[model samples]
Target: MDAFEEYLMTNLPEAPSFHPVFNEALQAMLLAGGKRFRPRLLLAVVDAYTPLLRESAYPVAMALEMFHTYSLVHDDLPVMDNADLRRGEPTLHKRYDEVTAVLVGDALNTHAFYLIANAPLHNDAKVALVQELAYSGGIGGMVLGQAIDCWFEGEKLTPEQVDFLHEYKTGRLIAASLKMGAIIAGLDEKMQRELFDFGLDVGLLFQIQDDIIDATESSETAGKTTGNDEDKNSYINHFGLEGSCERADALAARIGERLASFDAPLRRSLEALLKPYLARHKTK
Candidate 1:
C-alpha cells in the first residue's frame, strides 16, 4: 500500500496550461486519499498470482483508483450529492469551484485509460484492461446505476430493483477491479468470470454498508458527508437500519463462504484484506 501511494504521488496527471488551479484541483482528491479499496483489490490478485508483476501492476491499480476518484469528484458536485467533504478533506468542488471539479473529474476519468495504455504490459492485456474498465465504468454499468439512482430518488423501488440499480452503479466497477486484476494475471476466462461475480456481491455489500454508515455516522467519523442520502433510494431508506444491517450481515456471510472456496494464496490474501471491511456495517 505504501508503495502504491508512492507510485501515485510520483505519477500524478500533469496538465500544463494557462490555468493554475487546474493542476491543483486535479491532484487534490487523489492526494486526499481514501481506502484505495479498488486498487488494493486488483493488486491483491496480482500479488497472489504473479508476485513479480506486482510493481508492473501499479499503474493499473493507479488507473482504477483514478477512475474511482473521478467518480467521487463528480458525485460530490453540486448537481449530484452536493457533498462538502470526501476522504477527510473538502471535496474538489468545495475547495476549488464546480467548473474545476467537473474538469478535474473529466481529466481523471480520461487519463485512467491513458495510464492503462501506457502500462508496461502486453498490448493485448492493455487493450483488455481498457475494454474492461470502459465497459464496467461506462454507460451500461456505473453510469446506468447512477442514472437510475438519480432519476428515482424519492420514488420507491423494489428490493430487486434496488439490487439491479446498485449492481451497475457501484457493483460493476468493483467487479471490474477484480476482473482487471485477473486479466493482468492471465487467469482463465472461467476464473475471471467467477471473480467478477464474487466482486458484484462484494460491491453490493459495500454499498449497503455505506448506506448504514450514512444513516448512523457523522461526517467527521465517515470522512465524508452523512445523512445525505435521504432523497436517494438507498438500502437504509428502503429497509430500516436494522433491516439493512441484517442484509449486510447475510451478504457478508455469503461473501465469506465464497472467499473460503478460493485457493490458499488468494483466499488468505483476500480474507486478510476483506474480513474487516465485509462486516464494516456491523461495526458502525
Candidate 2:
C-alpha cells in the first residue's frame, strides 16, 4: 500500500461491533481504488516547491481524497445516480444497504474535515484550507452544481449554463487540490490564482472527455455504468460526439499552453503529472 493508503488504514474508523458494518462499508468503498487524481495533483504542487513538504502534505492530500470519495458515495445513492458499479466493484449502496452507504458518506465527509483540521500545518493555513474545501464542496460549489444538474435533467442547457454547471460541480474541488498545496507552500496569491485556473481548465477537459467516454465506451471498460448520461444533460448532448472531442482537444491544448508559462522545472513537473490525460486526447 502507498503512504495515503497506509494512513487511511491507520486513521480511518474501526470498531468493536457497535457499528462494524458501517466502518467496514466505509473502508471497503475507500479502499476500492479510483484514479487518486486529486491527491496526486495536491502532492505534485507541493513537490514543485519542496520535497520536504511532501510528508506533511500527506494528510491534506488524504483529506482531499476522502472528501472526493464522500461525494462519490452520495452521488451513487438511490436518490442520485443510483449507480451499481464504481471502480469496477459493487457500489456501497449495492454492496451494503442504502442507509449504510449514506452514513458512510457522511462519516467520510466529516472525517475529511477532521484530517484537515488536525494536520500539522499552521492554524492559519488550516483555516484557509478548511474554508477552501467548504466552499468547493458546500452549497455554492459541488452541491449547487449537482442541484442544477438534477433540476435541469432532460432539458437542453445552453453552452454557458453547461459551463457554469461543470465549473462548480467538478472544477472547484480540482482547483482546490492545487490551491491547497500552494497554501502549504506559501506561494504568492498571484501564483496560487494561476494554479487554480490551470486546475479549472483541466477539470473542464476531464468532464468533456468523460462525456465522450460515456457515449463511446461500455460499462465494463469504463468501470461504471455508461450511456446513463444519455437521458441527462451533458456536453455530448449539446455538442455532438465529434464536437465534444474537438472541444476536449482544444481544452487540452489550452492547459498545455498555460503550463508552459511556468518556470521550466516546475512546468516540466506539472506537465509530467498531466501527461497521461494529455496523451489520451492525442489518441483521439
Q: Which candidate is the best by TM-score?
A: 1
Q: After superposition, which runs of candidate 2 have C-alpha atoms over 4 Å from their true positions?
A: 15-17, 280-284
lDDT of 1 by residue, 39-59 (tens): 999998998899899998999
Error of 2 at 22 (Å): 0.8
Global fold similarity of model 2 (TM-score): 0.95
The pairs that clash in candidate 2 are none
The local distance difference test score of each candidate is 0.91, 0.84
Highest lDDT among the candidates is held by which one? 1
User: Any residue pairs clashing in model 1, and if so which?
Assistant: none
Tens digit of per-residue lDDT, candidate 2, span 1-284: 87766776677655456865776887876677788889888888888887688888888888888899999899888888889888888999999899999988898888888888988888998999999889988875788888998889888888999999998888888988888888998888898898888889988888898888888888899998788886677998998888887888888888888888888756876787888777534335
